[model samples]
Target chain A: MDLATVTARLLKLATKVSDEVGSIISNPELDARMDRVPANLGPYGVDPFGFDPEYLKKCMGMVSWIYHNYFRCQVFGVANVPEGRCLLVGNHSGQLPFDAAMVSTAVFLEREPPRFVRSMIERFVPDTPFISTFMARCGQILGTPENCRRVLSNGDAILVFPEGVGGLNKTWRDRYRLQEFGQGFMRLAIETASPIVPVAVIGAEEQAPTFINAKFIGKLFGVPAFPITPTNPLLPVVGLLPYPTRYRIYFGKPLQFTGDANDEDEVILKKVDEVKATMQAMIDDGLAAREHVFW
Target chain B: MRILITGIAGRLGRRVANRLRRNHEVIGIDRRPCPALPTDIVHHRVDIRRRPAEDVFRHAKIDAVIHLGIIHNFRIPAEQLHARNVMGTETLLKYVSKYNVKKLVLLSSGDVYGASAENSQFIDEDVPLMASQRFPEIRALVAVDRMVQSFFWRHHDIETVILRPTFIVGPNVRNAPSKYFRLRVIPTLMGFDPMVQLLHEDDLLRMLDASLKPGLRGVFNLAGTAPVPLSRILKILGKPTIPVPAPIARALLERAWKYRLTSFPAPELDHIRYNTVLDTSRAKEVLGIEPERSLYEILEPFRAEDQADYTD
Candidate 1:
């Protein structure tokens, strides 16, 4: 055989060696999971997205650190969350969704029985690298009305940011301004009879104050936006560190709307507007109540 | 009841025959002679397509016919497989209907569902058969499945119970996934982590036993274990997962498959990237049979074989 063919064969063999060693060291507790958990599944259950209790436990540990230490996140009115299926309508912000993470972390760690919030991510998320499977395994579904319906039907709480990309990619000037919410969540709540829990996340606005929305960068990299923060352009490495703002998450009372999913746009937008107004009012209240951006 | 089981020499077929032999009479038929069967159970060495299956049907009144003759090996040529699976099944189905057999059980694969991103979380029986779209070779099996279903609908008297089971692995069974898993290193498509389920040998045998019971008819997805991601399965087994980029991996697999050097073909790579998690609630509720072992418990039984190879 030629040298090239021989090199290819040798390279393949080397990859196997590295993978064996890499996973063993990287995931030191993998062997421990095998010993601790009953193999595969048990008589009573299984989460459809290949959700692993062990992996979720590991992730919760890190998210709790960020919630309590980094963000200093304080959740209020969490009792408003219904026992069964409900739509969590929150304002999406801070470029990175530290908002969703904090809300889910609150439910997971703080609540009794500990719930895992099924966050509906943007459509483009699954198209990214290692993130797709990671998100699925974490019980995050693609942000589609069909997927949302399915999750609610299963009686799981779902987090929906109706502003979609428009909310998360807003510049510093529009930080506190609520965008036009997507009408899908309102329709979902109506269709599945899932109560809507409007949430307002304060202090996330100052986290990564974005000044530039480079559409060119979004096109080049296939991202929602190529955002530029003060620290981001000035200090390349440390720029990613959002200012440790003291976050206050307020979960409002459940709002139930009765209507058909096949209702007119005007009909759906009215309900969507009501949810938006409630969230805006909460944001106003939280903003007034906050002592400082970082304490 | 006197029953006839095709491909009876195959691991699963033999197990099915052994189970049935305990209570009922069995006639095992295969193209290859099987020396391992019990003397009490009669064996016929004949290809269903070439020979008239009526010869066996005429010998004794066959109450139930279990067709397990579909060749699942990927190395076989497409034309030969079509002849063996499609034509052979057509001939057998005709004989079963003609011989006035009360029931016909056709063992099939879950791969018939076809793995894709578009599928819902847990696919029930109503989902379209999309497996043939990606891998045309699976068309023969799909055809058989459709034929069985049509026969079920067309004739009310002959009870046709079609089972589409997922990757079944145990000590004795051999298939694409098990063969790939047995190796020290397993290659997977990069950036894809499809959920997969496993059925135990006992679970499968039990399912076959359930089909024979009165009032069990219709299409059923026979699966017992909860679905697990491909990476976790490899990790649990202590086997290395070499995630090759999809394009390069596809080309390499096609070449490797052509040489008969690989256990899985290029098309099977699509499976590692996407998933088909069958909802087996019907199998549980209606059949009154639940898989005794969880997906992990079934996998646990195979650790000894995997560990022995790794140690060597």
Candidate 2:
């Protein structure tokens, strides 16, 4: 074949591949879900926190695919999320943050008048390379009280894993167990007068069943936790990938508590415990209803 | 109205002086000589800390004082910057109070809030000045802002208005943001696209004029039309950008600044990495300010073709 014919064939192949990818990414149902959600965009087509819905739409293709095909996320009680600002306090697990992604995607794709959930990421996440910019553009901000207050006041859904690294980095023995919750989320909910939607994400714990957690190693590497899973030590790169455990996301009823946000820690812990109890119950219920982890 | 403007030799001061000269008796005090100063307005070439600076107020019946004479050049020596900015502000406040000036407008900056991952998207004036914590070179400006704020409370008689405007950019303005934007190939921190705020020089002058109103006395944050990402601002100006990693960029900038090869200090890189957008609702409601210039108009001068001289 001549060079021109080869070039034309290559161009045709590129166009064909891109067209297929476009068709796969674009869904009328997803577009309809996006249309139902209210976005407060500035004149430059981004929110105050630098969230661009267009950017999110472009990036959600892979995540959306995983939601429908890979993990097959089953979401329930999304209507429990109130109209305005509310905190989505959920169990953090799966070693990686795929649980957070599944929860946010469920709310975005499955809820009525689909909601946009801004996940409060770890502080160190913003210091990472391309991930920081990608997260910001997709509507995740550094987990700070001020950012939380601002996001809540703007009437946007914010997903916060109050258990933090404790729940996420927990070993296999602690699977399906609730970690000690932080009182900050409760304080914020009371202060903003926003309801709290306790979330329970099942099957995430078994995805990367950690056998041992090495703290000193994590400290030396400047990471949150060093978990030793079976595949992690053997496969290295591929080990980072989580198992295809079917996700069941349960968003509980909106819990409203009225009191001083500046109250004592003891008082705040009681409120935090209430949220923890709700999540643990939901998680237990979800685990009982599930037949198999991979199904 | 007999108005006294300190730092009248600077770009903002000159524009303000030229505008107020039409209707009021304008008096300018600056150590630097302004060759293009209008012939009608009175100019006193004297440092504010010196004895002669007091004579400008002593000689004339100064009704109001517009204090914009802040030295924000990070290259200057620390003690000199502190002495000149803080002491100069001290001397000026003494004269304003002693002369019984009815209105006082101090030109502060939104940079006093500092760019941090911890900062809220729209920082209010109520937040503490934490810029010094990261960039110690900007401590003098933060100190001056705090000093004037205390003075505002003590002097109930004076209509003290502190205007904390974001990076002011214009054709003539040689401030950090303007010079940074003027770069042929602006270098940005890799993976970081912070939302930035910019106020046009003309809009700032309008706010300064409105701040001269009799009873509008409080610290107000002056922001531009809207806050956009730093990359978007560069895109609007049609400038090519090179995104370098944070560590390499900081190291290069430090060496370049030390050798006097670059004007942007290494610490100033934080401005491009994190958000410090200001809340302008207070200024809009109080001063009734509607920012006249859009983002494109604000960045028009720095366009690739419009700028002929690319000298640092």
Candidate 3:
């Protein structure tokens, strides 16, 4: 057979596998929840940013299972996420971005008329293999002001981790402390007049329990940081898997602000601090209420 | 109105000529001769940088000029190609200004807005032309686009419309999109499926026709259907693609390009790796130019035949 025939057959088989796996992971309730989120798909069943709801649904089964069984997530105040355009500004933790995933999953599951939260990923993410296209298909876009503005104007919910890599690569010593936030999201919120929903993800900071951020090593590998955790380095690949800590996701009431988007940095930072202070308060509250990390 | 179209021998140029010839007097200039030219349309065989190109404008009272003669042949030496494109455009702009040409339409590609991870979903005309930063081969195109933009502001009386359309794909067009899709088994970056926009040649012809209207002048980003993933586009065409890792693919393509085995430049791989979608709101609002063809209609020509031999 020609290469085309062989490749086509392989693709067909791969799709079949994903379809079977998807059926196993997907339940009627989860399907209904996904249906609530309106999809602005084109003729070929893809959104303008290449988000394919069908593809997302098929892969949701595994992610859903992880959300329910693995992490055993407890989501609160999901209704606080407004029906229209809003930004879910949250803390960036869990070196691998499992926090973003769990938070998005919680909203997708708990909210009535489920809102598919599009998270702005790191710039280097689009350069990575498999993860790049996979993330786009799953409704995540590159974090640019323009992208955020576009999605916000389209009345879609967006999740932003303003701390970016700062909070993500934090050692266990710095856990629960809020990192300095970037002011870009605040400007976009002001420009688009979208509400900011401060999200506090409690358990993610303890998942990896990083001992040190090997910056020099990371520079050699051309990554942001080389996170050395308890299980990693010794166990190699398998050790990199995060501990199954119980996830507590808190979605705060939507905060609204108005002003010139192009205002001075100090002016923008003041507004950004409001959102940051709210998140830190929420995080502290969630930590006090939680019984244990590994429930 | 008498319209002078450069690069008329090219597929898009010929299509534009045929569409415009019905109402306006069509005059074409190209180094290559158009074999089956209609009897009514006048054809001139000369390079835009040459004296004969100026002589045509010096004699005929040309009302409008469609500048499409910019060369995109990477096989040619960079210096020679750059001179031909930039110098040719400079010469044409001078002639148009001197001869009192009232209208000018230059066909630019959306690729001037380089594909990058930092790019917005729909890049508007205001975004800087940064393609030359990564892909040095496209420096001439970016230079020409900037030159035309300055010309647009400098001459108020002359209506200058710069139409930066996305990848043009049609039956007759032999652009990078068309040529890549024509491959039996296309090689794609393993982890990258950036959203891409396609413009049907016919829709582009329509936009060209629409731009020739009396008063419409400004840079308009012409986009076809909504942006879709590269994988979905290939799936629609039923073409099997081999997913190669980005670095390896880049290395192999660079080697092949050096040996003249592949037409695609290694730098151009960024197009497939990151988003470069254009926002066409200005085109929709100002020029009232909307793409007429559907996604399926645009890909129909590239779709594989159902009964094609697979065993061979």
Overall lDDT per candidate, in order of appearance: 0.80, 0.88, 0.89
lDDT of 2 by residue, B1-312 (tens): 999999999878889999999889899999999778889888999999999888888889999999989999988899999999999999999999999999999999999998887776679889999999999999999999999999999999999999999999999888788999889989989988888888999998888998988787999999876878888888777778898999999999999999999988888888888877898888888999799998888888888885453321
**Predicted complexes: DockQ each:** 0.22, 0.54, 0.62
Candidate 2 residue-wise lDDT, A50-111, digit = tens: 89887888767778988987899888888888889999999999788999999999988887
Query: Which stretches in model 2 have alpha-carbon errors above 4 Å?
Result: A1-24, B306-312
Q: Pick the candidate with the highest lDDT.
A: 3
lDDT of 2: 0.88
Deviation from native of the Cα of residue B12 in model 3, angstroms: 2.6
- Residue B16 lDDT (model 2): 95
Q: What docking grade applies to model 2?
A: medium
Residues A143-240 of candidate 3 have per-residue lDDT tens digits of 88888899999999999988889999998999999998989889999999999999999899988989998899889989888889998878987887
| Candidate 3 displacement at residue A245 in angstroms | 1.9
Q: Considering DockQ, which of the candidate structures 1 and 3 is the better prediction for this target? A: 3
Model 3, B216-295: lDDT tens digits are 89999998888888887888778778999989999999999999998899988898889888898889888787678988
Interface RMSD of candidate number 2: 1.6
Docking class of 1: incorrect
* Candidate 3 global lDDT: 0.89
A45 Cα displacement, candidate 3 (Å): 0.4
- Candidate that beats the other on TM-score, 1 or 3, i.e. the better one: 3
